[model samples]
Target: MEEIKLNEVEPYVWEINKEGDMLVPGRVYGDKDIIQHLLDDVKQGKEWNALKQIKNVACLPGIQKASLAMSDVHPGYGFCIGGVGAFDVNEGVISVAGVGFDVNCGVRTMSTPFTKDEILKVQEQLADSLYNTVPAGVGSTGDIRLDKDEIDEVLLRGAKFSMERGYGTKGDLDFIEENGFISGADPEAVSDVAKRRQFKQIGTLGAGNHYLEVQYVDKVYDEAAAKAYGLSEGQVLVSIHCGSRALGHQIGTDYLKTLEAASKKYNIPIRERELVCAPFSSEEGQKYFSAVNAGINCAFANRQAIAHLARKAFTSVLGGSGDDIKTFYEIGHNNAKLEKHDVNGELKKLIVHRKGSTRAFGPGRDEVPEQYRAVGQPVLVGGTMGTHSFILHGTEKGMRDTFGSAIHGAGRAMSRKGALSCCRGNDVLRELRDKGILVRGHSIKGIAEEAPKAYKPVEEVVDVMHNTGIAKKVVSVLPLISIKG
Candidate 1:
């Protein structure tokens, strides 16, 4: 790989000039140390060569202005993890690779009336209860079984289906992106195999990087924003991170094969087979998009069901009504959406694919929930197992600069293999316990794979976002107990 010329645009922003078929420049947001680390990764031939992925993304059809890579940028299927690219709807194509297999795999956080003092008393019991009530582990099935008709309703209604069935409150929907449901989902576009896979897994937390964490507010940065989010020091919070599970993986696998065979029919040149795509307006493309929307809804429903189970666990331990636990916000990082953006002084609707990136729409954007319209969309950034997570609000600068997108997580510094080589699962668990954190997992190997040393320091990543004006910090949280599936 040729040396990537990184121009320091600001304290936290770097730019790579357009080259080798790239239609626009590639931009990255990170501090000097991160940039150097990225360079080292490139030198070592790890696929996180974000510079190349950014350029590859710029070369995609109808990409406007620039291809933006967040500080968390790492190797992914087509786009890098933490990659953000927007293409003109009338002129662009949609690639299944841009949206990974876990369509709408995202995170949601909830605030609880309980405090650290109260939670500590039953921490172990809470962890055990949650693990039992919420189905987890590889290929785990739950009690919520859905037939074909019910599955269609779930795809159409998303979290609303669960809420109506007494899973959660209407307030939860108001705080979710698109009210937890993206319209235009066509269940008919979903394959029978995918449907069957989702039948028994509607409420389960699938394995691999998926988890449910019980945390407490560790610090407050922006007092006003923290107050608006109903967060205060020592307050308890629950975060659920998972995705569409088998249904989504099957959808991506099924459609990618179709797109691969049909790419020749559309005369779309293949720069990378993994980047296979179809014209946005084409029949195959539309069908795939519809199915992807259904997958997104599936995730919303999945999380809602998990939230219901989580509430039950909390009540069993805390002895209170479920009202004590209320949703803060839910956001999706995987998948693409049809959005209107200003491109070269002209506003055009486009299909924006944000893989491992969160939508950080600034204040006044209609998409922001009504209660939070003044403060901008909330951005949830999860750290490593024993690190600090942050709540950030979108900034006006972010909206003008990067199509209202921001970093999603700490991003892996080392692969799972590297992490396992460094430490054993039992040792990692003991260390976490020593640090005052309780952990429960379906497998010990899973715990070892996500060791804190495997990820970049989330604090540094958040600082880059703050310095770059992409998103401003609201508060910081530390984990008290975490459950991994």
Candidate 2:
């Protein structure tokens, strides 16, 4: 690998201008140092480069404007992590690789009345309680088991389905993105294999970068936004970060095979084998879209159920009904949405794919919940177990430039295998304990794979989004306890 040349098109915007095989230009949002670090990876001969993935996405059919990479960009299958691409609804293609295996893998943060001191005092007990309550790791199953009819209902109704089982409140839906459900989800489109995988997997925090964390609002950068979001200094927050579990993986796998053949039948050329897709209007594409919508709903329901478990764990440990533990916001990263966006001075319908990216709708967007419409959509950027996470508000600039999107997490700086080789799980656990962060995981290997050093500096990643006016920082949350899978 050599230096991958990029033109600094503007402040905080780097571009790999359109060339051979690219239908659109590739753009990445980050500062000089962040951009340079990405370029240096080429110099170091890193096999995977985010910029290359962005360029590959640009080569896909019907890509509109540009292939965009958010501030927390990192290489992943097909599209880079933190990649955002909007395709023309009529002409563009829908690809499974655009939405990773873990469809709608996302995060939700809730505020608690308890202060940091209060949670810290019983952190160990709370950790044990949460670990015992929430099922985790690969093949982890939970108490919530559903019949075929019930599973279909969960696929269609999302969090509301879980709430019907006495897991959450109707009020919680108000704070969830898309009101905790996406319309047009078709259970029939979801394969029988996928449904079988999900029957007993609901409410489980399946592994690799998935966890339920207890954090405290350590800092507030925007007083007004923080207040509107119900945050205060030293306030404890619970963040449930997981997804549709094995169900999403099975759905992605099932669809990939269908789309692979559909791509050929539809005469869509493939640049990368992983980028198999069908035109949006095609029958295969419509079915995949509907199935993916169901997968997204499954994730919403999954998180809703897990939130209920966390609340119960809190109630048992702290001795209260725990109404004060209210939902801050729920948003997904791995998804593709059909939306109407202003493109080239005309509002056109598009399917925007955000793989490891978040929707950051700005102030006044009707899609934003009424309570926060005056501010903007809340974006949750999760950090590694040993780092600080952040809350940010969407910006008008993001809507104007990147189709209202921002990065979703601290992008991995190293592979899990690399982290495991260098960091011992017991040593990592000890380090977190020394810092007063209690952690419980199914295995020491899981802890080692998620060691903090596996990711980039979280502040630097968030700074690019904040500085570039994509998402404005509201507050920072530091982990006090983490229950991992």
Number of clashes in every candidate structure?
Answer: 0, 0
Task: List lDDT for all candidates, in order.
Answer: 0.87, 0.90
TM-scores, all models, native as reference: 0.97, 0.97
Q: Which portions of model 1 miss their true places by more than 4 Å?
A: 45-48
Task: Please state the error at residue 53 of candidate 1 in Å.
Answer: 1.6
- Candidate 2: clashing residue pairs, number: 0
Q: Give a tens-digit lDDT track for model 2, residues 1-485.
A: 44467898888899998988889999998878778878887778877778878888998889999999998888788788889989998899888888989999999888889999998789889999999999999878989998888899989999999988988855889899989999999999998888988999889999889999999999999999988888899999999999988889988888888989997898877656667888988999999999989999999999999999999999999988877789989999999999888899999999999999999999999999888888899999999898999999999999999999998998887788899999999999999999989899998998999999998989998998998899999999999999999
Off by over 4 Å in 2: 1-4, 41-47
lDDT of 1 by residue, 319-363 (tens): 878886989999999979998777767788989889999999899
lDDT of 1: 0.87
